[model samples]
Target: LGYPCRDLLRAWIHELDPDSRQRVVGRAVSAPRPPQLKKLAVLELCTREGSAQVVAQKLGVSRPTLYNWKNQLLG
Candidate 1:
């Protein structure tokens, strides 16, 4: 599935109530191999206008790691 833009994602996350966030986390945990929360976090960070280096630094992940997650999530 195509990932939504960062602005949209931020808005969605901001609008989600605590209960809804729990449901999302719960759904992720239900997967056979639960997806990494960091991967999802990286994806969100990429939506911002930051460069790869900045995004990775902010998230404390490598640029390659962010790129890998971006491809996996977007592709």
Candidate 2:
């Protein structure tokens, strides 16, 4: 997704309640061999293909924070 589109989707997702968030996460988890799991799945979808800016926006976090998480996960 483009930066603006991703940002909008991120905001929309962030505004959802816990149950809604859980539903989205559950869908991601159920996808066979998905690259994401749990919190990571939420992040991946909200980002729409691992776009750092989108992920940060959805997460209400800075780009550096997203990078740190990625590093921790991949390292």
lDDT of 1 by residue, 1-75 (tens): 799999888778878753454333443232232368656665676677857788778766677867777777777
**What tens-digit string does per-residue lDDT give for candidate 2 at 1-75?**
545687777677777743464333442232232344435834574458657677668656567755665665655
RMSD of 2: 17.0
Summed backbone clashes in each candidate are 0, 0
Which candidate achieves the best lDDT against the true structure?
Answer: 1
Q: Which consecutive 10 residues in model 1 have the weakest lDDT in total?
A: 25-34
Measured over all alpha carbons after superposition, the RMSD of each candidate to the real structure, in angstroms, is: 17.7, 17.0
Score every model by TM-score. Answer: 0.42, 0.36
In model 1, where do residues sit more than 4 Å from their true spots?
1-36
Error of 2 at 25 (Å): 38
Q: Pick the candidate with the highest TM-score.
A: 1
